[model samples]
Structure formats: C-alpha cells, structure tokens
Target: MKYVIILGDGMADEPIEELGGKTPLEYARTPVMDDLAGRSEVGLACTIPQGMKPGSDTANLAVLGCNPRQYYTGRSPLEALSIGVDMKEGDIAIRTNLVTLSEEEEAYEDKRILDHSSDEISTEDAAVLLEAVRKELEEDAYHFYVGTSYRHLLIWSKGSVTELTPPHDVLGQRAGDHLPAEEKLRAMQKKSYEILSKHPINLERKAKGLNPANSCWFWGAGTRPSLPSFEGKYHKKGAMISAVDLLKGIAVGTGMANIHVEGANGGLHTNYEGKAQAAADALLKDGFDFVYVHVEAPDEMGHQGSVEKKVQAIEYLDERVICPIREALDKAKEPYRLLVLPDHPTPIRVRTHTSDPIPYLLYDSEKELRRIGAYNEREARISGILVEQGYELIRKLFEN
Candidate 1:
C-alpha cells in the first residue's frame, strides 16, 4: 500500500496557564484528527533522537531514517537545491530567515520584537530582497544567493566548513540566546542583518502600512546536503510540501521533485488552502507513491501563543486539506495509507522547537478505525502506536 504522510511542524506543546495549563493541541478542536485517533491505533513517535536537538531539518532526516549529525547539510542548502540552485564541492549554503525585528514590541528580544516573525514576506518580494542582499555582498568574497521566502544561500569559498553554525532557527536558538557567530562570522551576520533591515522592499512595505519584515536572521548555516534519493533507496517516487528550504532541499537533493505552491505561507499567518491543495494534487498524480505534506502554520501559531489561530489552522487542515484528500482516496479506492504526526513541539512557553515526544497515528484499511480523541500531546500517548523515532514511524506505515 502507498503512504500519505502529513507532518504538522511544531504541533506539540507544553502546558500553558492561559488554557488552564493545557497545550494548544489539547485545547484545539481537531475533531477529524480525533476521530481518526479513535478509529485507529494511536501512539507517540519521536522524529528525532532523545536529548538531541530537534528541528525540521534534522528531524526530517530522522523521519527519512537518516541521522542529522551525519546527514544534515543545512536548511538553506535544502531550499537552494529545491529551487534548482546547483551546489558543487566546497560550497556552503545557508537558509536565512528574512524576519522583522522591532525592539518595542515583546518581552523576548529575539523571540518577539516589533515583528520577529516570518511568512508575511511574499515570494515575489522575497526575490527582490534576495537581489538586494546579493548586491551588497560584492566584496565579502563569499557568494550569496537568495531563494524563496526569507531564505537566502551563502557560499564560503575560503572558510573552513567547521567555522559556522546553521543560521538562526529552532536549532540556532538552542546554541545560545543570540550571539552572532563566534568572531569572523559575527561581523558578517550583523552586516547581513543591517542590509536586509534597510532594504528598499522593507521601506516599501512600511510605506504601505504592512508589517515590514526588515532584517535577515541567518542561522542553520550548513554546507550542501548529500543524501540518497527515494528512487535510489526505496525504489519509490516521493514529494513533499514544506515551506522550509531545508525540507524542500532534502526532497530535491534526494532526487524528488519539489512541489512549489502559489501563495503557500510559512509563519504565524499563512494560507491554509495553498498547502493542502498542493499536497492533494501531488497525490492525485499517478507516479507518486509517497507524499509528505508538512504544515508550518500550525506550529507558528502555537509558538505565537495564538490559541485561536492554531486551532483555526488545525481545523482548516482537517476540513479543507485532510478531509478532501481522504474523500478522494475513498472514492478512487486508492490502496493508500495515511500517517499523521508532528516533528516536535514548539510550545507556547518555549516558542521554539523542543525534544518532547510528539503524537502519531497511522490509518489503513486493515486496522480497526478509532474515533478521534481530544486535541493534545497526552491524548496520543495512550491512543496511537507510540513509535520512538521517524524511521520507526516510516516502518510502521510500510509494514504489511
């Protein structure tokens, strides 16, 4: 049977006093997911190994059964490769977060600022910003190329591979509060940030009264990722719908066609339909046997502590994306299996990806369907098949 995997990035969470200490997953109205949980054997799965760092890139490697420390190149390179950016030997590509940072808005300087968010940046606008970033880097001796969203790529022709960390992300946040790279890279990242902050695009957005996502937050710096393809390893064609360049890069680097969607949003406020419809269409195409649908909006909403938006996105995925696909599969009588899970939790309290165990559920015609349970991490612990890592989850889906 074929597999339909849906990843809700950063969907898990810690208790929040706002919801009387219940995580967003617990408080949200995920009736469809709950129904699936009740009908199927529910369980918890760890996409990443325990006590190790947790982010989509590394965890996704684990899901693909590859070790991040051993296999991860970096997120930007993944995005760079997905968009057809050719990377050669000794080239380093980084995924830059084109985020807005204002000192007047929130408590956390890095987490919440006048803006400190992503996803509002449009694809066209992102291209413009990337060009601006490229123009300013003429004398640095490092090659800079911008990709989709706020993500750009950096190639260090003269530096050692070990001289940098991945750009700022959940993985970067784990290193230290917000120190620019050690010494040599520090000045570079700082200048890069300034150039992005004052770019013409930010000025244009600000003039229009829109949120100006000025400033580039560069983290998750990595060299080119080298991994085996789906056709090479599993003999099946695969595709993934994810906003992060890292994830997209992985798909492309591994020889999978990266599915680009119009109006696909990444951060707190994003387009739900775009993400869902993209996955649906990919599955409907005949040659694909595995489809990985990664949703970032839910995770972003949870990180912002916007319980309402988080719930709305979850429901949107259910009604608009998941439900429609389920219906299509049913009508076509496609011999397929659906696996649902989260990479890790970006709880409201933490506001970043965590190592906490996330929930997972697998549905096929062979198993007895269970009713959906409450929306929360704890609910899945007792309900679904609690596999320990991403590879295990993959095994469960493919098990006859």
Candidate 2:
C-alpha cells in the first residue's frame, strides 16, 4: 500500500475565547478532515520529547519516526543540507533571519524586535539585502547563503554554537537582552544592521510602509548532520514536498526525494493546490512508496498570533490540499494509508512552538476504523489513545 503524510505545521493551538472558546482547528471548516476522522484512528501524540525545545526541527523529525534525541544535529544544518551545502565536521551552520527592529534613539540592545520575519519579506528582496551583508561581513571564516524569504543560512568555518535566541521567541523584546553573548557573532550582527539599515532596498521598503529587514538575527546553530537513511530504516522509497528548507534538508540527509512545486512558498498565500498535485503525481505517476506534504502557513500565522488567518490556512489545507489529494488517490485506485497531524502547537497565546501533545489521525483505506469525533485536539484527546513515543507513530502507518 502507498503511504502519505499531510503535515499542517503548528496547526494545533489552545482554545481562544474570542472564537467562541474554540481553537482555530475547532472553528475552521474542515469537512474533509472531519470525514477522515470518522474513519481514522484518532488520538494525541507527544511529538516533542521532554527537555527538548519545541522547534519544528525536532518535532517534525519525531513525526517522521526519526528520534530527535539521537538524530537531530541542529536546525540550521538541516536547512544547509536542503540548500545542497556540503558541510565539514568543524563547520557550524547557523540560521540567519533578516529581522526588523524598532527605530529609536537608544542602545542597539534597547531596540524592540519589531518583526522576526521582516514582515515575511520576499526572497528576491532579501537576497539583495543578504548580498549586501555578505560583501560587508564575509571574512575568512563566516559566509552567508541566501535562503527562502527571511530565512537564510550562514556557515562559520570551525565556529562555535554559542547561546543565541530565536528572533520569534523574543518578539517585542529588547534586542540587547537576546543578542549573542559571543563577541564575534555579536560583532557580525551589528555589522549586518549597519550594512542593511541604509541600503537602497531598505529605503524602498520604508517608502512602501513595509517592515524593513534592517538587522540580521542569528540562531539555531549546529555542526554538520548525519541521519540514517530513511530507506534503510523503513524500506520505503519516500519523497518530501515542502517549501521550507529545513524539511527539505531532512529529506536530503535521509535520502528522500525532494519534490519542488512551483509557486510553493512557505507562507499564507503559498501554492496549496500545487503541493497536493505534486504529492499525487509522485505517488501515482512516479510510483513512490510514500509522500510527505508539509504546509507551513498555519504555523506562520500562529506565530503572528493571527487567529483569523490561521483558521483560513486550516481551511485551505482541508479543501485545497487534503480534499484534492484524497480524491486523486481514490480515483487512481491507489490504496493508501494516510496520516495527518501537526508537528507541534504554536499556540496563539505564546505565538511560538510548545511541547504540548498534538493530535494525530491514521487512516487505513482497506480497513476503516470508523472511530469517534472530528480530527482535532479536544476530540483526539477524548479518544484517549496517546502515543508516548511520537517517533514510533510513523511505524503505525506502515504496519499491517
């Protein structure tokens, strides 16, 4: 049987009183998910283990059945792999975000972090900004590589993974409090601001009332990654469809094919229909054993604390992605086992990833479980089926 996983990143959320006390998933019209939940084995899975930060890097690894405790190297290394950057053992990979800081007459540290994603600046514009940073900051050791949107990469030859805060984690906080303690990294960051703040591009963005990607904030650093081959472990020829480099990097390191869909940006307006079509083609036309489709919009909206947009994103996932793929599989007579879930909760309250137990649904086309409740956190919790080891949950999809 073929296998599929439609991962809605950061879809899970705590109940919001504004939405009639219902979470986004609870309020969103997810008819396909509701119907699938009726015939699917629904329950909660702890995708993030205790003592581990609830970054998508660790959580998605668990969803794919790779124990993060053993396999995860660092978040940036995975994105580096996705970018085809061959890193040596001593090379440290760090994620660099072109962020926006409030303009004020205080110390650089006193500037409040206005935006982590620089208002989700276009990659085309971000590339120009990064090029400026590279010319000004590149040295014998540290070099910058342009990635998608505000998310970029930096390779520090024989560098250290010192303490640095994720930009998203400290939204609206004083920049000084979270700046890297390491002198060299801090110096580079300061230089990046100087290089970008007055660039012609920032002036253009300012004129248009857009958040200028004024500063470079770095985090999620680590050495090179070495993951066990997914084919060797699962014996399935798998493919990954995602716009995020981190997921693509994981697929690359694990030897899974990366299916790039045109117009598939990892944002609210990302090409949802294109991603669904790609997964269907990879499974039916290409004859892959498994396909994983990850949608990043929901998580992104959650991080922005935009409940309305998060609900809209969930609706698009159910309609544009899930419904089309399900119909394609059915029409093609491709009997498949499908699993649907979020990597973790980016609760609106905190606007960041949390270690809370997210819900999961596993549907076997051959033998319908026909269980209770819709596909959501509350309903899944009511099922009372908890998978303590989230990494083992993928095995359930392949099991007979």
User: For residues 1-400, what per-residue lDDT tens digits would candidate 2 score against the true structure?
Assistant: 8999999999999999999999999999999999999999999999888999999999999998899999888899999999888899799999999999987777787889988888899999999999999998999898899899999999999888887799888898899899898899998998888788888999999999999999999999998888989999999999999999999999999999999999998999999999999999999999799999999999999989899999999999999999999999999887999999999999999988999999999998898876668989999999989999999999899998
User: Against the true structure, whose lDDT is highest?
Assistant: 2
lDDT of 1 by residue, 1-400 (tens): 5678887787777777777777777776677777776766667877777656677777877776576667776666676776677777767665556666553433333543333354357778977876776687545546667665656666665454543433324432422356454564556555555677667877888888777766555566666777877777777688878776667877877777778776666764555667666666777755687888877777777656677777676667676667777777767777778888777787766566778777877788556565646545787776645676566567777777
Full-model lDDT, candidate 1: 0.67
Give TM per candidate: 0.86, 0.99
Among these predictions, the greatest TM-score belongs to 2
lDDT of each: 0.67, 0.93
TM-score: model 1 vs. ground truth: 0.86
Candidate 1 regions with alpha-carbon error over 4 angstroms:
103-119, 162-177, 182-184, 193-198, 207-209, 267-271, 274-278, 370-375, 383-385
